[model samples]
Target: MPDSQIKFLVVDDIRENMVALEALLRRDGLQIDFAGSAAEALELMLVNDYALAFLDVQMPETDGYELAELMRGAERTRNIPIIFVTAADRDERRHFRGYEAGAVDYIFKPLDPVVLRSKAAVFFRIGQQARELECQRDEMRVLAHHRDIAISRLKAHADNSPLALIECDRNLTLRSWSKGAERMFGRSAEAMLGQRIAQSGWLDAEAAGILQTWVDGGTSAQRHSAEIDARRADGQTISCEVFGSTLCDLNDGNLSLSLQLLDVTERRRAEEVRSLLIGELNHRIKNTLANVQAIARQTLRQADSLAGFEQGFVGRLQALARTHSILSDMTWSSASLDQLIDEQIRAGTLDAARLLRKGPTVQLTPENALRLALSLHELGTNAAKYGALSVPGGEIRLTWTYNDELLVLRWEERGGPEVHPPARTGFGTTLIRASAGCEDDGVSVDWSASGVIWTITLSVGVAQPNQPDQERLIEPAKIESGRPELDGSRVLVIEDEPLVALDIRYELTAAGAGKVDIARSIGQALEAIRAAEIDVALLDGNLSGERVDEVANALRGRKIPFCFVSGYGRQHLPQGFQDAPIIEKPFRADALLPVIHELIRR
Candidate 1:
């Protein structure tokens, strides 16, 4: 029934009695139904709810007591309040029988309206309160269902999160481990729960100690953020950035640490790589600066005036710049040999008819390409000044060949002025020999009567640090007559970096050294020491990736004077040459030549 309606049922064998009671008890919000017989009342009771039922005690086929017995027996109608109505005197035995049949009270036939309304009002209020309670119970059930769904979603989100999430109790025992944590640490939740975090073998001893210190240094609610070195199950080192906060559980106000760990190992490694690349770039730049310095000095030496100096220096610088541009296009990796030749020809403005290029395909390493480009520029400068290019209808031929293990290149001038060796070796000849590596027979120049011919043999393939291309041909020039420091002296320049070696060779040649040999590796330096009488040597403390200690030891054994030319500190040099003369790189010819002069004098 509606909450605003209070229903009451009244039954009698006489219609007048029921009608009189309904008229007496009826009011707003109260609904009264009249039934003529006990059977009609029983049928009405089964289908509709009633706050109170009033039945006559005396009836033809059934009495109020009998109807009450039936309502008491039924589960659906048993709880309806019953009030027996009769037109007889009160008796103890009758009252007992009415009470036994589930009657709350009995009303006489000429009913009092005041007493009836008071009794009925109590039951009506009780029924309304029951309906209110039922509605509240249903609302509570819906709220509980919604709460369960929210908890399920929150749990799923935590478990599937990409960052590792872990919760631990006040005692540092793991209480919750998400699937993300499990995957990151390679440990299952079953194994981790109840395990003390610091002792769980997840963090290294030092990291665990640091964390413990953090916890003990502050209150339970303190937050922590730091990057820590962690370890996987396989014992490999990993880096993680940890963010931690102490959370108080709402239910019991219990404190626990919640941590989110982010993996940063790869990012850390990339930073290290960037640092190394920057260092290497700094080293290469230093080498280039040294080359420029060498060029300026040598150009000054050969120039007849300021104009000649500017022309020569700027041309060499531009050639260096052009070579760098070409290498930069390939990311400084390698350059095509023929492509380099063609570029140099175009840059030098060489006559296409007078010069022939015949070469198989070859790739030169970045350093080799640059060195050869500058060397070729020097050759062109000389040829234009005195060789084939100086005369009309003069001709030049260039060719190259490779035999898988070695590469050879040749430069020949067929028609020009009668070729003859100069009294003193020029910078061009010195650079060609210096950059050609220190191997014996690596480079040679033949001054034929007709013109000049140059041949360069380079070892290529696997063992070389980078691709091959070295050596050059130019005007024949022997050592210049000079002061006693280096007249007719034979020297060894043991260095790995080609550009630095080239500068050293130029300096040595200008100092009147008759022959300056170059060695780029340990074995090559050792072989050079054993192959010829090296009056003095310049030994790089480190050649390629190895210490050139063997070369130093050989020089010491031969009683040949040599100095350590390196960028390393004295402490980093090889064993037992502490007293040897040393010159750091980015060194000048003025600073370097005196040391060799002293070594030769000694």
Candidate 2:
């Protein structure tokens, strides 16, 4: 074979070995150089590039490892493939060390001529391919840089042009607007971008409605034009032809919306002046709606009682009012979900632990928030009147989270009067499921007489990620009945309910209590405990005559062990005393036995 392309370096203490390696590789079209030691190899490499280096493992002053490390440290020869020529057994540690020091492969001292030639040829082709790829990458980088510069220039020209250009995302948040938009909208470009066009005063109600008509399923990627009025930053309204189109980039496949404002002030002002009569017609229509509601309310009020009216007109009016209020608060744009929940549930007074409100923490755009709040208000009003929060012995907990892009909120009731699910769907239910003006499905309210649980999910664009728990607001764990076992100890029962007092006496007798006393009022209970040797007292909260908390204080003063029995919930109890034994009303006999025993056992 002609020695035309490949290059190789041979290093060894013996000149005869270099000659033999060079002769063997010459058959593969390789040019060979000789170095008698590592120092000579370093000198040759500094001046030229070699495809492969054959280093003798047993050099005198600096071995193959030392020489390979030197070549690897030099930038030019760092990646040159090294082959360690050695007679040492492959299992020897130093022979392995030679490979670790950057040797590509190992060759015994009596090198096989064919094996040497093949290895050198392998590295030469690899090096040539690597150089080619590096050149291609550099070219791609140059092309990308030029593309970015072209895009930047195009955007700058678009911004400086006279026509107002507005770009918005799917949710209608302005993503980009040009200098012309800033001038026409009476706002800075920086202030307008990322703001909703409606909020930035770029389009009036009529113009926005027309634009929305185009935005919803108009010919995809086609321009739409209509004449309407837009508002400027100075609060001055101008006549304009609003042009809108869906933008689909063919190369990148990104979907966007583009809106353009062509000032038709002189051409359209005459038309708008003539259309002032149309604005009056719209106002009349709104007045007609209010008049209809008023008439409905007046007709419903003719009934003898308010219940019929509440179901018919009042509920509808409240829903409408809530919607209006929410719209006003959001400036008719969007409402925050958290703010709506806070407003509707403001009346619930359960302890932080008992009342929990958790969710995605994203603000609902005005329309969704308004509809959801109206539904939740109905749920809230019903709970305030008859559900868990209505009675003293109840609790309501609300929590929500976003799972898989779906928003779900849950209301759980506990420690409440026996619940029976709502017998029939009422106005509250209808308002919840009403899909009148919202993109989301209607509210879902699950009403149990025990309490009302409601979940409202509306797609309000993209949902937010789950937030970490703000603070653990869970109810403290109930203190297990610390009541000692009665163990024949004297027990006192102070209760206002005659039947309940008699029942406690019966329970204590069954439990083998030595003595039992029942008191209907705090005064009587106080006297009985003072006069008797009472080991344990089962006190009833809400005595006919006094506060049960005061009775507890007196019992504690007397060093008497006492547990409370009441229909009241944790919410009704005074703060800082949740740990006390509180047996819920209508508890079973077996439950009472444990408390009686546990309290007196001590």
Candidate 3:
């Protein structure tokens, strides 16, 4: 109803007093109704709703108090606000009696017009608000009725649809089954109804238990979906996708579930085949790229002329091929560290009596196997050229120990020509130092007069007997100029090549990124992005064959600044990422550090 139609009732035996009261409460949106006596006021109240009532204290036969008592006794007028209008002097007892008669307030004789009108206006606005709330409740009831109709229509449709539909009670007993369900499961409703769904042989024990758990734990609003192997009446298993939801039975108000099943055995089989093929392809491509990189590095290092480059390149390729052969035998999972050292160092050596090796059994991951194989090759080549192996009487001892989560290797040479530090570090020296491990001061070389003694320390994650509980060793601190301290910033590196990933992690830590996370696949990268509190990210433009655009977009959406570290150039990137900085592959610390600092500052 419109606000303009609201009514106010006035009661008094004196006609003049009623007129004065009506005029006092007069307003544009108010409908004022007057009654000459208590009986007349009660009659009008029986048929109409009032925002408020003004009742005189004195009356002919039935006083205002008596009329109010009758109104209170009935449900219809009990909550109507009453204001007592009186000519009597202000007496405490009379006021108390007025309250007992359900007067919400009182107005004295010769009432102040301003006070009376203001108080009545307050009740009028409150009545309007109450009416609006009631209207809203009515609209909601209508919507609920329509929703019930829709559910009924859905039930009818399910009975005739091709997909199987079954309903079960709270205890998982079959309450209803459609014709589609009977055909799909090869059982009639008469045989299944009122029996536990598990007894019907439609679902195996494990599948049934999983469904039951969801039903018992889930609320009426939750809809759960699962793929399970279901058994039919003939004892044949088929993969099916089940959609289940909890609902209330309208007739009994008991909890029940509605389940729909669709066959998907063929689709699942096809997807598995496709996933296996893709995984194998990505593995082969990445391995081939790593081999090419290794060959290029060695070729450039040993090449003084075209002939020298060809000869060195072929030797390095053969060495890399041998390592790959061993890795392939192990399905590229891991290789024994001792086997790797022997294969790489003792390949073409005739005087093997000069070399001594000692170490416990340790397995190296495929990436580590390749890197260490190259480093050992470089060290052996140097020794053959200028160090111990070049002399017939020279001797070299390789001893290693694992303790406190640190793997320490000492390469000591004696009985050779006097040694001195090189004027400039060569690529072989750099590769050996990096592979052996260098954090602050992990790699050290003693250029004694007798020979060179190299001590290298690496942090190993796997635990062994007598090893320290800590998974990593504490690194010594180093202060480097032009490298800003990240002050414990969290960094995420998304690279698929394991060696490159390790390099990025090491550099990030050395530059003061307290936490460095590695993600080798797109799925793992996305998971890390969500789970970590990342301050900056170093993203590889591509992960295997998939581009890192999705990860970059997610970082952008979160306002996390990141730069791409890829082999590709700017034009090769996706359209929207042209402006994002791209740190080219074979990253240098000088180029990478500034970009990282700028990203964090921005």
Candidate 4:
């Protein structure tokens, strides 16, 4: 309303006088209202606010004098300034009457335009000043209201934030302690405010010194953050992360800081545990890899031929893998004895139907379980080849008994070919004996007339031997009744992994093969075949991830008698090599001997 037009009222019985006065007063931001009689002027005054009123002294019926009296009587219209419009020939009594009737001044009938404007401009200026003052008052009221709301919102944030919010001067005198801060230190705001920061006793002497130094450094927000062990009101020590910043209030000449702290005790503990687990994992991995490498070397040294070496070496690796799988399932703590026996027998491809096992539920530590698995696999394979399991009617009874101090496992055979002691100890015999790790009473094999009887005795809950000594790696007497026909046969081995290729070379050379050649990729294999005459070749089913059919075709064209060696079993054989004799990885020398002999005959 103050910003709208400034209006003024003019009351006159004659239209000419009113029109002339209205024109003089009318300008930008000013509105003039005209009325012919006292009744009309009173009505105009009641509905609108006017800056100035000019009334005629002489009028019909209800005159200007009566209107002035009426306006003065009413509360809404009393404050408006009124000037009388009169004739130039007015008597003194008429002038007195106008003055006494509440008219501030009089104007003549023959008006002076410049004089009229000057007088009316005074009242208009006063009205404008009053409106401006009122507007300024309203603006100040709004600004005060906003300031109160802002303070309330800031207080709410300080009370409800998850982090402890503390405000202090650079000298470390506390200024504000939020509800969050109170909860963290177990102290109330009233008790904390105005006190020195360390007075709350939340930190130890050393921790307090560190925090004081940091505050003195005048670091910006989040520029200085640290983890410190702090004490709570209950005297419990906890890890806390402190973050702070210097406030931008340099004009006050006193520096301040806003500090926030969060509890990180659980997170620190978790990190410590994770680091220990990583170290343990790394140590276990390195040890396991070394053990496997040694097994491969020992198996190769005693193998009589490539075929035998593949069989023995692969079987040992499989046994170790299966044992590790069970140990992993048990978190490497212990393993079930029944599970170890079942896995080793199945992996050796032995006839479980002809065997019976009777034992109470038994659990062995990880180390003992590994050794026992290797021994069981060897015994199973020997029975299938030459002892009880060779005949369908033969049966092997395995039984075990364990107590607090000792564990005894027995293997008995019946209804098979007559048994007799071998001429020399084989690798399997040495392995099972070493696994026993006993001098007086360990492992024994009785070549009884009915079948072979094997028994292993071990100390329960005692440390077994970690690994067999390399000096104990015996070169066994040949298993073949007659010397292998491959005596001096030149052989080519195609395998991708370097260690596996070297193992194959060792076995073939030991088996009386002459000048064994090795190739990794298909191109290298084909080139080797062209450079020399190869009597027989062992083809890897897969080179990297691809089928090695192209290299097989080259061998076929050369009329070389070769067999497929695949670790993935028959399902993964090279497409065109289906007609070739195939042997899976990890075969015993006996299994490979027949494959090589068959190829030689072909």
In order of appearance, the predictions have TM-scores of 0.59, 0.37, 0.36, 0.58
| lDDT accuracy of residue 598 in candidate 2 | 67
Task: Identify the leading candidate in terms of TM-score.
Answer: 1
**Which candidate would rank higher by TM-score, 1 or 4?**
1
Off by over 4 Å in 1: 1-142, 214-222, 250-253, 305-307, 326-339, 345-365, 389-409, 437-443, 456-602
* Model 3 C-alpha lDDT per residue in residues 469-550, reported as the tens digit of each score: 2221122222133767687888999889999899888878888898999999989988998888999988887888997778
RMSD of 4: 11.7
RMSD values, in order shown:
20.4, 27.1, 23.7, 11.7
Q: Per-residue lDDT tens digits of candidate 4, residues 67-108?
A: 888999999998888899887647888778777767777888
Query: Each prediction's Cα lDDT score?
Result: 0.79, 0.68, 0.77, 0.78
Task: List model 2 lDDT by residue over 340-417, tens digit each.
Answer: 554443322233445666555665655456456556666656565666667765666777766666666676776666
Clashing pairs in 3: none
RMSD of 2: 27.1
Model 2 bad stretches (over 4 Å): 1-52, 58-63, 87-93, 113-129, 218-221, 239-244, 249-254, 262-602
Against the true structure, candidate 4 has what lDDT?
0.78
For model 4 the TM-score comes to 0.58
What would the per-residue lDDT of candidate 1 be over residues 115-215, giving only the tens digit for each residue? 88788788878867766677788898898899999989988887888788887777778888888888887889998899887788888677766666655
Clashes of each: 2, 17, 0, 4
Q: What would you estimate as the lDDT of candidate 2?
A: 0.68
Residue pairs in collision within model 1? 425-478, 438-518
Best by lDDT: 1
Cα RMSD for candidate 1?
20.4
